[model samples]
Target: MIFAAILAGGVGNRMGEVDKPKQFLTLGDKPILIQTVEKFYLNSRIDEVIVLCHKYWLNHTKDLIEDYIPNAENIVVVEGGELRNDTIMNAVKYIEDNHELSEDDIIITHDSVRPFVTHRIIMENIEKTQEVGACDTVIPATDTIVVCHDGNIISDIPNRNYMYQGQTPQSFKILKLKECFNKLSDEDKRSLSDAAKIFVLNGEEVAIVKGEVFNIKITYPYDLKVANTIIDDAKLNISDAETGEYKVNLYDFGEE
Candidate 1:
């Protein structure tokens, strides 16, 4: 089974003076979390959608889903963990407890704030993870990457050609991810920046899936403004096909 884990564990500390967490904040018409969920829910390739939400907002998350999504039996809201990776583990644990586990099963983890994620990115993540054991979505770095060991000065400057900014749906073979995660020492686990780092530290190969620049995470107030503009443009680009399915040309927002 292919599961898409939508991580909504953040409390929106950076988004100062908000009534609720940033995920619950309205993006265009619906909450950012709901829009993110719908992206996966609408895709026929994904079998299940698991929402890992912070404990404090769990009920609110459930209520929002119930109100917005019709017949959302496949989508489940579970309590997130203290850490980002731990929240992902919670999703894995939920899957193991409720459903049959298999070695080949895939879990695609994504940030709930990134509502602009295109269907193409989701499909590529699944396809690449099936081919390789793991994959991370990223885009080429447009600026020179400066490595600063200390806040005072830059230790080294890396070539921009080799540098890429990381993004999610970081996907992995479910069993393989669990095995790699288990091998990590407690200290190493605590220091992890993201799940793909586990594979890197374990000498495992992780393939790359190209990500869109418009696949931005809503972290601050300014981002919400940018997201609204993107939504307006997306509406302009949307059109109906002969089969009666609505196709959104997110590429019009510089996705390619």
Candidate 2:
């Protein structure tokens, strides 16, 4: 089975003075989290979707269900935890408690703020996870990367060719990930960031699939502005195509 878990548990601390969480903010016509969910919801490769939303936003998520993914028996909403990994574990526990899953079953974990994840990314993750026990979506780093401590001096600069910026839809085989989590020490559990890291710290090899640059996580106010611009541009392009405003003139090249 191919399952998707979207983490929407953040409090939007960096988004400053917002009435709602960042995930609930509007990008186009729908909430950011709803847009993220719709990617998996519309994917033919996904069998089910689980949304781990903030505890305070449960009712709002339910309301979204009425408008967006209405009567979606395959979709579920559960209260998220204070920490990100806790939210993922909650979804894992939910699956274990409710249904039986195998090692071959893949669970794709994504961020709710990344509303631009495409179907191509989702399908690639599904196929890659089936080949390897775990996989992560990433893009080749275009900028120089530096390792620094205390926000002062750069300690090291890794080769750019070997570096990648990790994105979401980090997928793992059900039982394999469960086993990795079970083996985590107290220190590992406390410091771990995402499921992909789980495989890394455990000395398990994870495959990486190419990700798009537009699949950016909305972390700050600047990101929100960029998201709106991208969405508006996309809408304008579509409108231009539909209205035949985007046309080619052969007369520009010759007198034909």
Candidate 3:
């Protein structure tokens, strides 16, 4: 069984005075969370999608899915945890309680705000995780990466060739992820920036899947504007063969 864990646990502090979480904010015609869910929902390879939403918005998340997606039987909404990793564990707990949890089962964790994730990326994440034990999607860094240990000054400048900006659909074999996570000390667990680091800290290899430049995460007011532009450009560039209607190209890896 394969699961896609859509993390919608954020409170949107960085997004500035928003009525709701950034995931619930509109991007183009649909809410950002729905758009992201629809990507995994449309994929035939994905068995189920688990949305870990903030507890305050759990019902709203369910309502959004019910209204936006037809026959959403495979999608489930559960209350998210206090932390990102804890939220992932909540999804794991859901799978273990409701279905057969096996070592071979794969869980592909993605940002609920990253609606531009492509089919090629999703497929590659599953394939690579199956081959290697874990995988993280990333794109080559276009700018010089400056490492500043203190906010006051730049500590080091890393080689651009070696630097890559990490993106999601960070995937892993279900049992393997759980095993690695259990080994972490409580302090280490609290300091984790993302799940892939859990494997890295444990001396585990994580394969990388090439990500699209347009796979942007909508975190702030500026990002929402950029997301809208991306959607409009995709519509202008692509047209449906059958309907002769302009549509956003959400599946393909290439630029629209």
Candidate 2: segments with Cα more than 4 A from true spot? 243-256
Candidate 3: residue 178 lDDT (0-100): 92
Cα-lDDT of candidate 1: 0.91
lDDT of 2 by residue, 35-62 (tens): 8898898887888899998888898987
Mind sharing the TM-score for model 3? 0.93
Clashing pairs in 3: none
Best-to-worst TM-score order = 1, 3, 2
Question: What does candidate 3's lDDT look like per residue over 124-239, in tens digits?
Answer: 99999999989999999999999998898999998899999999999999988999999999999989999999999999999999998999999989999999988886665555
Please state the error at residue 50 of candidate 3 in Å. 0.3
Clashes of each: 0, 0, 0
**For model 1, how does the per-residue alpha-carbon lDDT over 1-256 read when each residue is reduced to its tens digit?**
9999999999999999988999999988999999899999989989999999988899999999999996799999999999999999999999999989888899999999998888889889999999998999999999888899879899999888999999999999998999999999999999999999989989999999999888999999999999999898676556433335645454345434
The C-alpha local distance difference test score for the whole of candidate 3 amounts to 0.91
TM-score of each: 0.94, 0.92, 0.93
Residue 239 in candidate 2 has what lDDT? Answer: 66
